[model samples]
Target: MTETNDTANLIQEAEYFYQKIFAAPVPRPILEKYIAANRKKMPRPDERIRNLVLKKADIEAVEMAWRFKSPRNVLTKKIHILIYLAETTPENFSLFFNTKNKRFSSFIVLAGHFVRSMGKFLKGKFLLKRYNLV
Candidate 1:
């Protein structure tokens, strides 16, 4: 019963992440730029479902492919990594916000994410200020 509940929770969490990240339509400019750069087109709906099936391909390889893909969109890459990690390695994904882990490496990883998030937040703030929209 516990195993079943855990599986349900995992599925729920994965679905939540998928909806939040991938459901939104990409901005037109970014989509055009991505196409112009010839980066991997965002996976088709069926392709996404197929990739999530563990019986098909190794998830780590999938994760690494996204990781090394064009660095032109670091934020999107990071979110994709997070989604993959959430789907395949829930423990590791939890570690991104976990405070109980005493491991130095985990702390470093969390700190790195925090820094990146703050950087993006500040950048947006600056842009808003420049346009007098904030």
Candidate 2:
């Protein structure tokens, strides 16, 4: 019973983070502009249009807010990426939330992929340190 409850809590936490990261409401004007621009390029399916609009909105929001330079923003971005991966590819991330069949191998695989994905950000930090710029 305890294990089942733990799994439920883990799932809830994952969902909470997913919503927090991806559920921001993009302004209607931005959405309409993206839709119009995309339509001019080519008449694609609605799903594809939606994806492109959201991507653009996310980029614009980050840029407008000037979030790229802040350490806290970087950390939040990392967490968002991790949560997105876990939600999209549950097979790779399920072990952490599955209490009954927890395995070290699965954890290692997930960690490796995460580190690889984060390499660019980490490299920047390392370069700064190497040149005594940090």
Candidate 3:
């Protein structure tokens, strides 16, 4: 029972992530239909079912082709911190890589540096103006 619930949750999370990467609309109604019926089963693609993913084989092929880990894997914990600071969208995150590699990590670092510099500049300007009045 516990494993069933855990699998269901994993399927739900995977579907959500798939929605982010895919251009197709989510098959929420179809997923809900299966979830309601079995309550303990994950959705397996069938002709009648509206599969949110492209296909199982397609996903497997991509996984096999790119077995390499993401460059920012080292900063997994700080990733959220960087993402929160960056103005980038999820759609563009994968495309962020350049010839140098780890573009998103570089972008996050550059963004943090720029923000800190901008803050310092603003504070200096404010202090200069506020000194005579204060």
Q: How accurate is candidate 3 locally (lDDT)?
A: 0.38
Candidate 3 residue-wise lDDT, 1-134, digit = tens: 36475446435534543444344433554344434433333233222111213223232222212222333321121223223322144443554545566777988999997886556545544432343211
Better of 2 and 3 by lDDT: 2
lDDT for model 2, on a 0 to 1 scale?
0.41
TM-score winner = 1
Residues 39-87, model 2: lDDT tens digits: 3533333332123234332322332233345544432443444444544
Candidate 1: worst 10 consecutive residues by lDDT?
42-51
Clashing pairs in 3: none
lDDT of each: 0.41, 0.41, 0.38
lDDT of 2 at 74: 31
Comparing 1 and 2 by TM-score, which wins?
1
> What TM-scores do the predictions have?
0.26, 0.24, 0.21
Error of 2 at 88 (Å): 15
**Candidate 1 vs 2: which has more lDDT:** 1
Best by lDDT: 1
Q: Give the TM-score of candidate 3.
A: 0.21
Query: What is candidate 3's CA lDDT for residue 24?
Result: 42
